[model samples]
Target: MELLKKDNYYHIYNREINSETVFQDANNMSYFLKLVEKYLIPKVNILAYCLLNNHFHFAIEVTADTKDVNQAFSNLFNAYTKAYNKQNSRTGALFERPFKKKTG
Candidate 1:
């Protein structure tokens, strides 16, 4: 239902649950970016980005190879969340379920 179609442009964003701090420190940001590079850089053409304490945004163009863009993003978020929870000793969801995106 929330597929990111190929050949489309999207503005993507998500926030931590309840506006909780997602990036508690610089390492968290670095890890998230690394995950993004690992999962998303291969699939889409990233135009711009903004990373904050509790949220992040990306403007990207889906490439032909991005057939499973949403899954790739999910992997990125899940990986980040797992590591974050282990690092911070927290539980439950970190980001709000189902990230937001809009074609543009």
Candidate 2:
């Protein structure tokens, strides 16, 4: 994982493990965004976002020089994964190993 630089834009993305559906229903999408707002909104400014069945993407700009940027993302995914696992009655990794990012 790369350290997110302040004032830089990035294209961030991740996919569900084994191409399984990450969002089972509309409520799952809402819950995922709520988690994003809780954990990532303070760390980055979201420029755009798209959520599909098995993956999601985000265009964002880092707003500050904070060491917790990566941790915020980890927290966001972990929280969502936990809720998703519990709700779906499944276990193990929910997403791919490391989320991907690119300068944009």
Candidate 3:
């Protein structure tokens, strides 16, 4: 994905590792959204979101460019995966690597 330059828009989505459900409950989903708010909201304006049983999506408009925008997203996913794993007694990657993205 591009660095999410200011004023550009992007749609980002990712699925769970294997076919496992990433969001097993409401709290799990809420926590993931919280991670997004905590991490990516600083870098972009969240326009929409879709949280499913095994995958998730986000639409964002970049507010500015600093370092790599992907890092902000990476931080969001990594933080969520860490907490989800600990809470679920699982030990491995949660979302698929290199989450997908598209420009519009």
Candidate 4:
């Protein structure tokens, strides 16, 4: 589990279970990016990121008086899941966990 305190940076990674292709093509990846910009970038600081077929990596920072990182993550994940499910006609969890966050 990740404990997000104030003024800290974390290395975060999330993977699709069973190594399924969460992002099948460039268009899917683009859609995910659109959702991130629409919902995530405005809320938190995303220092670095790399998106792959079944997972992604992120280096991010949180404010000192932060309240909920989970909510922010959920918005992005749920939005992507909804879009992916609608596009691919599938239903299930997109990520394996609550997103691993290591503070540094």
Q: Which stretches of candidate 1 lie over 4 Å from their true place?
A: 64-67
lDDT by residue (tens digit), candidate 4, 1-104: 55666578888788887689989999988998888777666556889989999998888887534556656778889989888888988888778776787886
Residues 1-104 of candidate 3: C-alpha lDDT, one tens digit per residue = 34557788889888998977889999998888888878888889989999999998889898857465667887888899899889989888888877888987
- Per-candidate TM-scores read 0.93, 0.95, 0.90, 0.87
Q: Largest lDDT belongs to which candidate? A: 2
Q: Estimate every model's Cα lDDT from 0 to 1.
A: 0.89, 0.92, 0.84, 0.80
Worst 10 residues of 4 by lDDT: 63-72
Model 1 lDDT, residue 73, Cα: 87
TM-score of 3: 0.90
Q: Which scores greater on TM-score, model 1 or model 3?
A: 1
* RMSD to the hidden true structure, all candidates: 1.3, 1.0, 1.5, 1.7
Candidate 2 residue runs with Cα over 4 Å from true position: none
* Global Cα lDDT for candidate 3: 0.84
- The alpha-carbon deviation from the true structure for residue 17 of candidate 3, after best TM-score superposition, in angstroms, is 1.2
Tens digit of lDDT per residue, candidate 2, span 1-104?
66888888999999998898999889999999999999999999999999999999999999867588888988999999999999989998899979999998
Pairs clashing within candidate 4: 6-64
